[model samples]
Target: MRKLAVIVALTATVFLASSCRAETVCPAIAQASVVALTVAPEYVSSVKSIHLKACQDGRCMGADLDLVPGSTPIDQGCEPGSYGGDGVCSATSSPDGTLTGMLMLESLTASLIEVTVTGTGAAGQPLPVRALAFTPRVAYPYGEQCGSFITAGVVLDANGLRQAA
Candidate 1:
């Protein structure tokens, strides 16, 4: 009985020591307040130029965003030389004519923000202005220990602007 107790105690000690040395390793990734914008597919080809203006806590920023072909991720293994791959799988973009852009901000503190989206068509004809007053969401995407980040999204469609779900 004494030998069994000593063995158990030694096992417990080794287990505790090993666990103490275990750590949560995180990647060295930079964080930012990025607002992703997606133009509806039906209007993607029509919108040749996009201008975005966002305001929060009395500070406002405006700039023209360069729209690019949008893609969604696939669970299949990544192909060679694919951008933003997880080393296991890559994103796939179909030629569906969907264009997307990003509106980066120095920081977004206020819960509520005002946004204005304006653009021109392929012929320089102005598209209808889309505006929205919505709140951004805060998330700890990497984990709570990694800290929180504020993210916002907007959609521009024939119906106008609306916050992303």
Candidate 2:
């Protein structure tokens, strides 16, 4: 009888140990440090090219941004006279007359960043230089377990260079 009790206790412990285990599953994705820039339509029309200089943690990197036409997705709010209220949902791509570029950085270990932006006018004249000093924001977009990434955004508009919200 004592042997049978010992066997049952061992089985119960094994079952409980197996049931108590939890698995952690994470998404498969990659992330990098990048600075994204945007030029307002009003400003984009006047500039032919953009040159960017960025410094962080005593390291400096420079690049001429390959600005591309920017677009936004618009939700028209469903289709008319369709099955269910979901019919009113529709999306359209609209060009906002903006130009955008992304600049990859080695790292954003420092809190402070110094940036210089120079533009060439459509007529081949040099536009005024804009400089800004600001702190970048860090995020764990895929959750903390997936690691962290840093990003900075600047917009050039009629008001000149400014941090993006």
Candidate 3:
């Protein structure tokens, strides 16, 4: 009787443990189409390359834009990185060409701005982009805190350029 009770208890514990296991679902990552990046007149001359990325719930998607070592800035650039990887920009558009979401970028010292392109082809297709501007805001001194650092409101895309429904 004692052995049977122990076995039953172990079985129940195993069943409960298995049932209590939590499931983690990763969010879907989509590629972003960069249409244009315009820097302020003051930054236009000093700007080199602008790294862009899309984010949902604080996850950065696409390639990191490094705008330091280059000659002649590019007006239009492709999505920085590949999908499901760090330093990449994800798409905020639905299956169709409509943009109901936005791609975000991490704040750096440089000023930048992203614009969404829409319509059809080179003249009309919809393209949404998040622009980051290099401004004299609060700077994090070298090494300070031990948490995620986020600088919001650096890029203004208030026109619903990249909003996904």
Best by lDDT: 2
TM-score of each: 0.72, 0.72, 0.23
Better of 2 and 3 by lDDT: 2
The lDDT of model 2 is 0.84
Q: Which stretches of candidate 2 lie over 4 Å from their true place?
A: 1-22, 75-92
Q: Which should have the higher lDDT, number 1 or number 2?
A: 2
Which portions of model 1 miss their true places by more than 4 Å?
Answer: 1-23, 77-96
In candidate 2, what are the lDDT values of residues 71-110, reduced to their tens digit?
9999778555655555446789999899998778887653
Measured by TM-score, how close is model 1 to the native structure?
0.72
Local distance difference test values of all predictions, in order: 0.83, 0.84, 0.36
Clashes of 1: 0
User: What is the model-wide C-alpha lDDT for candidate 1?
Assistant: 0.83
lDDT score at residue 159, model 1, on the 0-100 scale: 88
lDDT of 1 by residue, 3-119 (tens): 999999999999999988857766678767777889878878778899999998888888899898876655556555556544455456556556889888888764899999988
| Order by lDDT, highest first | 2, 1, 3
